[model samples]
Target: MTEPAPELVRGELTRELARAAVAARTGVLRVTGEPGGDLHVVHGLVVTVDSPGAPGVRALLARPGRTSTGVADLRVVAMMAAVDGCFAMASGWIGGCHWQDAPEAAGRPEEAMPPVPGVEPGWLLLETERRLGALAHGRVSPHRNHLLLTERGRAMLSGPGSGSRREILLWANGRRSCRDISMLLCRSLYAVTVEVVRMLDDDLLAIAPVTPDPPIPEPVRGIGRSLLPRRRRGASGINDTLPPRPPQPARGQRTLTPRRTERTT
Candidate 1:
């Protein structure tokens, strides 16, 4: 059997896991205590958790490979890393403990931070890109960030790279798929998918079901023929033509008639 197309694989995975990390993070992020620090009890494990402070959630992705978050806003930042893969857990201060030290009971109840093969300095960041791609309703395939967008997205579009911000609004008049947008801006579909899904995550975009392929209308003379058996050229066959309904009277067919009232002296 042929393997599913990459885009199809992405779409299906998106359908299945789009909420996996978010759900996981939501469970953990919410359990955290104040940034000063509190205990987060998850799946029955006791974790000394701290919420982010100061500049807020934006600081979460600013520094990846975190052990302490090392800055402010460690709680939300840690959750952000959990959802995106291990970007913040790769190194540095926050990366060391928060990410790497998964409660010994953490992940079999397995291990929390397992080794990833062929991982580089940027692997988790890249996987974060893929997770974003998995959030789209449209077909999306994975790719890199050498310049994932003519502009970057949540990763850069609204983060530390905001100085170079650009508009991401797509025109309603233009008929282009996410893939087309990716090509136009010199990005990969997965990258664009990240932007679109983030927009969705933030209520910036909402997706409506799309017609992947146009439907074929019934044939002129063979409509509904499959439901019935084929007839000989001269033999009678099932009549499948639908009759047109009579039109209703146009509006204003009846005009309003004002009634006169008699006044008593």
Candidate 2:
């Protein structure tokens, strides 16, 4: 039997994921490109993801080689790690991806690849759009040192289940810039920058001025007010009716009027 070569199609990670989601395929997405990674999906739900430069469950867990316990803890850690890994993997150009039957486990430690916290395909798509939006605005310099929280942002934080959005709000603090926030959060600078930019686009965040501006002097304000003259309050001052005209003389003769005013006792 003649063996067939693996099909290689070049596109974006989001595109491939969209196709898989629409078809409701249960398979492993093997990606190789600028930032390579593997994502496992069952019936269009993302189960796990592995990517370089992103911390997985093993790296996140406190006990790497200790007693195996706490299935619930493992599940939570796995979920966070998987989402982070997927974010890292989906970023940048995607060379190609190969889809195949879903595997029992990925090529990582069982603890790190727990089968919990499956993400909806639609959610993944939304996340990808957010990251791309952030990237478009990531041109912001690393030295930026100011951010202001909007009313909408405050409202969002006040609510529950904002997830990374809440974390970003907490770190923003109106005093730290994107770079500073990233350092404080101990996450990727690019990741933090993306969030910052997206918030800015959505009007949820604003760049704070480095130095507080001086208040306008009271004298200056008064001067400004004085520049404008007050408007007249009464009706039209000019008389609409004209006084009676002096009697006209002949064409060749001249006419004179008395200058003194008439006095009455």
Candidate 3:
């Protein structure tokens, strides 16, 4: 008889990743959930993380009118992408995950970028947890909440600006979320989220209320009319329907008469 394949214990994502790292596993852990992504593990170390919720190395390097082809630049961008992607995956809901053996390829083919140094799972988890705690304390969500610039934000833009703050201020028009701005600017999601939260604290930004989707109308029952039964004739040739009558006050209740309206016509 053939033996069953060893099943990976299902539990928290952090625990599973730690287990894989300890075992020195070389494979891809495909996590499934909202904004899910894959973690490329090499000899128990996480080299890269790919998630739709955050921009990747290529996107980070593909800034408008700017190009970087140096190996050093690539490594820096890859490191940022890995950390940001891990945060993106952990911040949201994770349904489940499964590991797949990939002995041949080091990373995804579509990446087309050279591999950088591998990051330890413990360090990655620690960094991600730190970021998560900071974001939670700031009451900001990179994926869900939309932001808008306040009067102070516009004023701040008029002064000498540095980093991505000016660009973020311009983009927060009560329509785009932090994730949207991150993709548009090709910046790290964690960085963008942190900046947005800071701006919010400085009274430079405000959270925009998300417009709820319109409720779906329920399907009408039956074909034409309602499915309710119609009035029927009684055995005495009278309709079963009762005649409309004015409401009467209950016993011991004061019955106040309604005021009559005077017609001018």
Best by lDDT: 3
lDDT of 3 by residue, 1-265 (tens): 0111112112466777888888888788898976889999877888889999999988988978767879888887888888899888777767788898864646776453236878888788778777776776677777778898788888887788745688898888888888899999988898888888888989999998879999999997666556666766565554347674677889999988799999998
RMSD each, Å: 25.2, 19.9, 15.4
**Model 2 misplaced regions, further than 4 Å:** 1-12, 63-73, 104-114, 140-265
Q: What's the ranking of the predictions by lDDT, best on top?
A: 3, 2, 1
Alpha-carbon TM-score of each model against the true structure: 0.24, 0.42, 0.71
* Candidate 2 C-alpha lDDT tens digits along 97-167: 78767656556655444257678766765655454444643544433447778888888888876877777
Kindly list the per-residue Cα lDDT of model 1 for residues 1-265, writing each as its tens digit.
0112334323322332333333442123222111221223233322222322211133333433534534344554544434322211111012111222234543353354322211222233346445433443433221211222323233444454332123344321124444344444433333455665454455443333344698888767755858787668735433345555566668879755698999999
Number of colliding residue pairs in each model: 14, 0, 0
Flag the better candidate by TM-score, 1 or 2: 2
Give the least accurate 10-residue stretch of model 1, judged by summed lDDT. 87-96
Candidate 3, run of 10 with poorest lDDT? 1-10
Assess candidate 2 and give its lDDT. 0.63
Distance from true position, residue 26, model 1, in Å?
46
76 Cα displacement, candidate 3 (Å): 2.8
Cand. 1 TM to true fold: 0.24
